[model samples]
Target: MTPAGRATGAGRVFPPLPQHPDPQAPFATSWWGNAWIGALEGTSLDAGRLARGRAYAREGHVDTITVAPGRIVAYVHGSRPRPYRAEIRMRTLTPEDWDNFLDAVATEPAHIAALLDKDMPHALVDAAERAGVQLLPGPGDLVPSCTCPDHGRPCKHAAALTYQTARLLDADPFVLLLLRGGDEQALLDELAQRNAHQAAREQSATTPGATGESLPGTLARDALATDYRPPLPAPLPPPAHPGEPPLLPSLPGAPNPTSLEFLATDTANRAHAYLTTGTAPFPTADPWHDAVRLAASHPGLTGRRSFSRQFAELARSVDHTPTDLSRAAAAWRQGGEEGLSVLESPWDPPAGPFDRARGALITADLPRMTIHHNHLTNASGSLQLRYGRDGRWYPYRSEPGRDDWWPEGEADADPVGAVTGMIGS
Candidate 1:
């Protein structure tokens, strides 16, 4: 009944789950899938985005999704020609948490069957929580990021992808485990070992005066000397597709049944993938990038008027300010991970479009321009052109008495033309 903390699997890319054909049909058919939707909706600060995201999911805007330990990534199309990349990330469980969860499951054989059948009872969940294992996402657990410029904690595109993810969970609960850290086969394998040890201990217990030191066991070296032992079982095959999310029984005082089911569905899918492929997902290489990503996606940092207290304490712990967070957050809103890299890592672009744009700006003869590392600014410092490592131009306008900046213009490929267009606005 406890949410197993340590699910085991590497990352896997999943094809987009089919959009429901009927408009009137519910987005999530199974109880588990509904639970996933509930977590997303309940945590989101912006109702408008949730509504739009639901609409987008129904219309089939989300692209192929990649699920890995602690993260979900996909592309969602909106008003633009290019689909925006969106991702949601959560914290994985610690080793102790996994040990406790697996131990709990082993204590009751039915729990194992319940998971295999894609259902987790509230009793197990309560047991897990009692032991300090959080099986389902609560508010602020979901950290959302997007390449689009919208400043919403989860913009419409991210929301849409999140909505679609619920269906994937409905199809397979193992995906939830994958979200945590372990895959289906790995967990099962561990459970099987526990069962074996338990049986051995029971046999030893029945023996008269059998102490711990008197337990019957053979050394691996001795066993290897003989060849009569049975062969190991064959590797497990992957599920044809991730199965449907398991159901949690409805009961009074039970945790949100839907949310548990949603996680169950997600866990099932991940287990399926791990069974098929032995490969595991790896974490991103850059530590700095990861930190910035957390800051940008913090639920409290969504807007000027809206802030999460949790995010505030987190920022202070890391010695960062809201202004610093906003500056990087805005850059992330524009360019995702790359924008953060560009914001601090100054690099001089080779002479090409940047040079051409400078010439064009000079030709206009509006004001004397000063050039610094990757930046072109007028004498008044009101208008500036900051070039990215990728050769794309990001325009920034200085605010009176404020050091921070926001992107003002569009059409970055043609920096000169873009400067003429939105700088005036």
Candidate 2:
């Protein structure tokens, strides 16, 4: 199969460049979950880094190799210790077994384990064990034996591969999982089977064995008939206590509650509202962190839009709603020229003082926002840019040697002038 974002080349798959370059601006330095690296230990795979390694593999880069159960084996180019190739161990599933496994996985969702039985390498090996799968060491698991007499962990070629894979996995998780034998659906299926036999046993015990008979199919069907589902009882009125006032009122001597205070209290009632709901859009740093933390906590979620949707749902309330730009910006870190692009796309020309007024056309005020730009370079040469704010024209151009962004000074100077400077310099 072709690597993501790339076309097939002579029947061989080549890796594609990143589709989205900038993840937008204000969100650049998001440190959402303290455990992005730490948490990998609890799962069979480092869904995050495995993703990056897959991208490296696509480009045909020698730095990284991805395998089953979301394992990413990276080699150091010339670190020191060299690794040896293990005996080749190949297992081809029989047509029947493969079909049964696929069918079983298709019936449910995740299926990483049943498809592969290797323990995850790296710090996440423990995580894989917890999830009940072992990511194994096989061909392509490590670099070929190194000639270096030093016996260091990895030589230069292996080290280079390791760095490259680490960078790749940092960018995409799907690629990592693909390298693993199963995808999310496959993993979930394996997990389901582990508990399934217990459920079947419970059902058998509940049935009577006298006369060697089983519950009649028709009677069993009737027991679960939707038409016979019990009707939901009407909501009960708040209970009344003997001699209690008909309705709870403001404390006798306390001042009456104001709408604003009531709204504020309402927001506080929900979980993580401060991080979730706010009238202001998420600024670059904190917003993305808040978002990734949520996604990392919940698997199978991806893309910048997913973060936007989750944040909206988590913070859905009036008081927590950002009523003004100031309130919105408050949710993010403060910096000057940096602050301007807090709620804007990085792909667009950086937001200047003048753009602030234009935000009113979309809404009375701009919510905190950030534009993400991912600059990718590989066999494929595609540019990916995503903007957060609604109205604005983003300008982009190519510069030799720079894939992620234009040089810092160039990004800020007049486009015409910047081009001239590049030519002169």
lDDT of every model, 2 decimals: 0.69, 0.32
Candidate 2, TM-score vs. the true structure? 0.23
What's each prediction's TM-score?
0.49, 0.23
339-393: candidate 1 lDDT, tens digit per residue? 7666667777776755677787778764556678787777666777778876677
- How much does each candidate deviate from the true structure in C-alpha RMSD? 14.0, 23.4
Best by lDDT: 1
Model 2: worst 10 consecutive residues (lDDT sum): 4-13
- On the 0 to 100 scale, the lDDT of residue 90 in model 2 is 17
Give the TM-score (vs. native) of candidate 1.
Answer: 0.49
Tens digits of lDDT, candidate 2, 40-124: 2233233444344333333433422323332233222222212211111113223343334434433332333422433222434
- Total backbone clashes of model 1? 39
